[model samples]
Target: MVHEKSCLIDVPTAEHPRPAAAATLLELMHAQGEVERLSEREQLLSSLLISVNAVLWAIDWETRRVLYVSPAYERVFGRSASLLLADYREWRNSIHPEDLDYAERSLARVLEQGTVEDREYRIITADGQIRWLSDKCYINQQVEPGKPVIVVGIAEDITEKKQLELELHRLATTDVLTQTSNRRHFFECANQAFDTACAQGAPLAFLLLDIDDFKEVNDSYGHLEGDQVLRRIAESGRGILRRGDLFGRIGGEEFAVVLPGCVPEMALLVAERLGKEIQNLSFNYEGQAFGVTISQGLANLTEQDTTLDNLFARADTAMYEAKRLGKNRVLAG
Candidate 1:
């Protein structure tokens, strides 16, 4: 990515013309020679730029053999280009097992539509290392004598970029402390669940949780201690729940969980699991260990519901009832 300065321009030191006409002619000739050399150097640099960084490949349509592969194959695939040239199947084998199906589909679509499909795939090196590769291939539309319609491709290594994108999405959707879904992502997924359940006439449920005496915990200890309690409780909730559940921190001491394809009874069981887990939890904040409990509320999404607010209000009311009835139980409505 770093480069040294190139000598594309040369300036003469003299501010004025030479004393004699012969001297002027000599200066002009020298400048002309420098210009010609630079032009040739530019062409060489262009070739190196493509040869070093880009992977160029060609496939013979009639024989279905790999006709050409640049030397960059070793730099990327950790082996000689001749391996793939001898048999295209070797190249196919190098592709990731999971991505093979997608690549095949794209190839088929290209042959049928005569339009290139831009895609990404995983490649395995000679040392059994995996890398993310991006490919750009288009069909050669022009016809020529004694040659089949060949597919030309150029590829680059984009593993780092892909990793960064995945990391970003994870952070954007997950809570920093407990690694649970944040409020924004939770609502989006829960709404989708509602729509799907409505179309299928399936039942859905909602569970609301609130930490008992959270303010007292923060005041008796400190904000840091309170944060630890929150994290521990959130983690316990996540561990107790199933993958089909949607859990998120909705407020400082409040959380919401959605259960899809679940009725009121199953939802109550799930809420009880979370509450029991929290009651068993012991926090060691600042070396002072203490116990904590949670209150939960459950609601079933009936076919008559129109908006999320309707379900949320019922869950909220039930949670308050649980809190009023001594704070360590699940209240269902």
Candidate 2:
């Protein structure tokens, strides 16, 4: 019998390998190593993106499509990332109505400026909470010659910082004791009102009020009772003044009011009402009841008054005159 010739060749071993076969095996090994390294790097990058607090996002400028958004997007925006990716208007709808125009214009400027760093605005979240964001965006510089423009941005939640700033401003501008405008802030606002009234050719009146025998009250009733009196007087003044009027505790026992567009008669009427309100407030200390009164001096804006200081000076003089004449009365300077 004739035997058929065997077609199978012997497998090459490492000790006795062909050159081409050896090269192929080495290439396969190298490719496998490269793929493993690449996968590890991808995992590390994903971990970093997931761990960050700020939202990282990308968008296709030409299509107005959201390309990618990191995990933090859902946490900060209180909205679904899937929805944002599905429709670009999801982002637009989240912007505060008052800041929509500004947000759009600032984002558009990034096309010409290459980067926008100082973009800050407010957004309404899905839960109807208003949050502030400091969103910075830049154009990708590695695009091909002809390709859709990609915009990348990082948005950081700055709501806490903004709230802190507002609180600090309130502390700086408001009196801690009486909850009215402090001395410095009162003058600042009064000066602005004075200039506005001058520009509009409107009548403005400044009224300075002093609590009568305030020192004696503090001595007789203790400092706590004196503080209560001050607060009650401030509340009464606030109740009597109009919306546009500026009231502030300018001194220990002195409060000032700047009435915009008020004639002399209207200012006098407001002062009288405030005085009566103060007089009606009864205080009790150690089972003893006592009441307080205020002396007020009113001054009207004149052509000779160049600044608020001039108006304030005349009112101050009149207030002292009221004190000298009798307490619990109003006098026009």
Candidate 3:
């Protein structure tokens, strides 16, 4: 395509009016060549921009109108650029309700501070899928004084990245053998529960339990059977516990349960019920039948309990007491 500036290239007025006119013809030819080269480069740049896997957009600061958007909008968000350009409010509406305020605040910050680093937010796509996007935006205010202050933004889909991150976190926080919360995550959850219980003045119960003869089972059968026993125990406990209760494996064959809104008596009842369920589970390894039992210690939240460690220690002591009294029994501290 020829530009208006390209059409103004001076050519020879006469066949050979003078040497100056001949020189002007040469200059026109050179200018025409340069314009063609520039046009080719522009086409290449446009192609690259459209083929990219990111959303490239420019918005008019004054009108908040979408000045330009790349074709990738359809590929990424399942929406047409025309729809966005027709009404910039569509862009705002596309943001997830939980993240709309954050997105707006980020834009406001860019407008106020004149620069912004990359920020991440979620969006509800046209196809009804949640997508994570990382937006890198900057303001361009160096244009003509009367012209609009433009904000140029590039947003890329990061949903896969976010999912992978969550998977890794789950792996880190969960027990590999029992599929329960690991020690560190258990403590993290317990700390939160403790703080909430203290703030709300609500009752909380802690149960520390140990599998009876776990080492003997591992020694008689292979570690594989031992793992199966642990998994079974965890499954049984989860089935017996409430939705809000927290159960985790704190050590080898040692597990803890946090029962929110539970008093000492209720906690003891839960422990007894869990022990009964475990006692009924029959373990068979190559036709050798056996059963597993758990000894539990229960403790309730008290005003003197300053930290989770204190509560956990009392429960642990009670658990040892149950073990000392006999196997497969519950004790209260």
Q: Cα RMSDs of all predictions? A: 12.7, 5.6, 7.8
- The TM-score ranking, best first, is 2, 3, 1
Put down candidate 1 lDDT per residue, 166-223, tens digits, no spaces: 8999999988866788889988888898888888989999888999999999999888
| Model 2 worst lDDT run, 10 consecutive residues | 9-18
TM-score of 3: 0.79
Query: lDDT of each model, Cα atoms only?
Result: 0.83, 0.94, 0.91
Candidate 1 minimal-lDDT segment of 10 residues: 9-18
lDDT of 1 at 298: 84
Query: Could you give candidate 3's per-residue lDDT for residues 18-111 as a string of tens digits?
Result: 4766779989999999999999999999899888999999999889889998888988888878989999988888899999999999888886
lDDT score for candidate 3 against the true structure? 0.91
Q: Which runs of model 2 end up more than 4 angstroms from their true locations?
A: 1-32, 142-147, 242-244, 263-265
TM-score per model over all chains = 0.77, 0.83, 0.79
* Count of residue pairs whose backbone atoms collide, per candidate: 0, 0, 0
